[model samples]
Target: MEGMVVSTDAYASQVGLDVLQDGGNAVDAAIATGFALAVVNPEAGNLGGGGFMIVRNDEGGVFALDHREKAPLAATRDMFLDEEGNVTEASTVGHLSAGVPGTVAGLWEAYRRFGSLTWSRLLQPAIDLAAGFEVRERQVATLVAAQNGIRQFESG
Candidate 1:
């Protein structure tokens, strides 16, 4: 392979490159790239989000890892509804709407089964990138968009 990476976010692609260059396999690159996404693309890549993973071993065995987040233990079908059964705004906004996170656990599970590099080593690229990133105009625009979304939920 020529070692090419294609990602919507450049930083994430770089993270993948770093992992692969470090002698890590695809699973390792995936884990590191996912972590880097969480830092560089927080709007959609936060740890609070969960996702699936598919891995194929050299022997051709394939495995799917389901890391999608689940509702909190305290959640219920009607928890966000009012007495009259109308959906409350709480059901879709603010902290109350958040589900339990599962990304880290899912990544760990996949790595344990299919990884070649140490987990800590794979994570270092993301951590270093996060520590060194300087906010740019694009990120400022993202913040403005996020602020508008937050304003929509604000009572005052």
Candidate 2:
């Protein structure tokens, strides 16, 4: 069977295609594409976030994977409220508002269930991209536009 991959970034799509061409199944291609996006499309793709995946095998078996981020055990409904009980920006920004990241676990689970390629093989493309890749004009613009927002936090 033939497979095709489309993503927001050309580099990510190419990574997926490379996986498919190298005898990887759809799940493996998706995993590679996702990791590549984390490096090449940071504005929308990130390892710190969670996502969902639905797979249908050639035998007509369907599976749903939910890898959504989970709130910390100590989180409260009013955790983002200020002293006056007004909503604060705390929930929308900073480390205190972050959820337990589930992307890696979710990807691993998907691979365990349906992937054919080795995990390291699927991750190599992303690793190469992260080590060094050309930054295009669009990416430069995006980084420039986001600099101020990213600079607001200490981690930036």
Candidate 3:
């Protein structure tokens, strides 16, 4: 994707445009762009998010993939209940808030089926991002402002 390495807010759409301009397939672009968005916009597009995809080749061959995760085996209505049987907010923030994470699998299937690039190549972005991604001003300010409420996450 040329000149398509945009911010979290714009990577997906930009990547699709790049792919089309570069003579690549549509699904290829969507998959690349989608994964890029997830890595760049973790708070928004997460590994826990689920969605569906529809695809058609130049010859008009169509395929669809459902990438939704199922409920965890360990789940229960009271799983998030506190000692007083109340729904603790913490239970809705951390691990408990997490549902089945099928995003990786979804990305993997797309990359495997329609991707012209190697899986490793796509992942290099996320790896590099992790090692060097700068925190946005909004994120820093939000964290600082919410520190008192989310202290547990910051605590060791």
For this target, which candidate reaches the highest TM-score against the unseen true structure?
A: 2
Give me the displacement of residue 107 in model 2, in angstroms.
0.3
* Candidate closest to the true structure, highest lDDT: 2
Q: Rate the local accuracy (lDDT) of all candidates.
A: 0.85, 0.92, 0.67
lDDT of 3 by residue, 33-107 (tens): 666667666666667787688877668889888887766898887877779998887565776676787878887
Please list the Cα RMSD from the true structure of every candidate, rounded to 1 decimal place: 2.5, 1.8, 4.2
- After superposition, the stretches of candidate 2 with alpha carbons farther than 4 Å from their true spots are none
lDDT of 1 by residue, 19-120 (tens): 788788888888888888888888767798899988888899988899999999888899998999999989778899888999999999989998889989
What's each prediction's TM-score? 0.87, 0.92, 0.65
Which ranges in model 1 have alpha carbons more than 4 Å from their true place?
A: 1-3, 151-156
Model 1 TM-score on a 0 to 1 scale? 0.87
Model 2 has an lDDT value of 0.92
Candidate 3 is scored at a TM of: 0.65
Candidate 2: RMSD over Cα atoms? 1.8
TM-score of 2: 0.92
* Model 3 worst lDDT run, 10 consecutive residues: 1-10
Q: Report the lDDT of model 3 for residue 143.
A: 62
